[model samples]
Target: MSDRHIQFQTLSDLYDDVLPADEREAVRRHLQSCEACALEYRRLGDTLKLCREYAGLSLPLDGLNDRTMSKIRSARTRRLVLRSLPAMAASVLVIVGVGLFSTGTVFVRDRATVAGSRLSYSDSERVIDIIRKHNATISQVTGEYVEGTVPVSSFNDLKKSMGFRRVAYMMVDESMPDENVHWGDAIEEVGHDTGQPVRDWAPLTGTGASRQYVRFRVFR
Candidate 1:
């Protein structure tokens, strides 16, 4: 057989010890005659002996494993508590805020009559009645019912005339053919024309037969 074939069979038998006695004897005979096979056998034996020696030695400890595990557990607990604190605080804040808001609403509802008593007779009238009494003219244009400029002027007059502590404006846009043109848009347009900011004129909703209306508040 070739030297390569002999080396392969010899290494296989040396590692497994599975070759028959006759074959083992033949490989041993060939190893004794072949210097290359003897050198390989010696090198494999030395490597295995070194591995066994290293395996028998005890590995050194750095004390990091136990400390790291303890730190991890501590950090996990801290993270869990930190995460829970915000939710707990948020729940408390929400509960307190809701309680305060509810209390304020109840207080307002209880004192509504007392608050209304402070206002004058004309001031207490519904905005639509106030608008009509002030001789505020109304016109229908482009299928939209537009209140005349009198509402704005009368509102000023009512504030001065009745000593109306707070005068508010009520506008109804009863556009039968179109609902898209909202009161807010009208208020904004009016505000722009009046050289006042839209937000400065507090615009609220009013009921209409077929369209929407905006109500402006005059508060003392």
Candidate 2:
């Protein structure tokens, strides 16, 4: 009933599981009597949970950081240009619209798809380890596919280390819409579409490389 509320740092610490046990318990007890703080706490948890779920992704239903790293890498290739080019869309809030047309690279904003039947089932642990080293999150893994997001800057490293092919990629931008995409589905589709084997493919830079996710899907 005290109009006093807990501070933001306390709530953040609690969410991160970093607060001392006594402070955590005190916060919980306060939540029992306080509606507003509890609601805020729930919302924070929900948002982070949804973000984590963003990694186990699939197609156009698409959609860091060691976050400072993300900004640095994302800035490397991703340029946000608002210009009046010939026949440009009137509503060009677009950042990654034009791609290397000479290579016939089809552009889908904010996604990078990788695939390989060559991805050995035996390297499951190695794959996980590499992803882990990159500070990426693995959202889901079934026998057919391993799905997750990695730092775009480091994506090339991941591609080379693992034999998993870096078949195709597009820029990741904040302005993109959220869709319900998944890794398993993307690999199957891209492989069929591009017809490139694992060895023949080039590495992904996410060159428009966003950090928190240069999402990857590899066939297991």
How do all models score by TM-score? 0.34, 0.32
Candidate 2 segments exceeding 4 Å error: 1-122, 164-212
**What value does the lDDT take at residue 131 in candidate 2?**
65
Model 1 ranges off by over 4 Å: 5-35, 105-220
| C-alpha lDDT values of all predictions | 0.47, 0.53
Instruction: Give the per-residue lDDT of model 2 (tens digit) for 16-91.
Output: 9998888789898998889889888988899889988996665453113366777877775454222112113311
- Cα distance off (Å), candidate 1, residue 69: 2.4
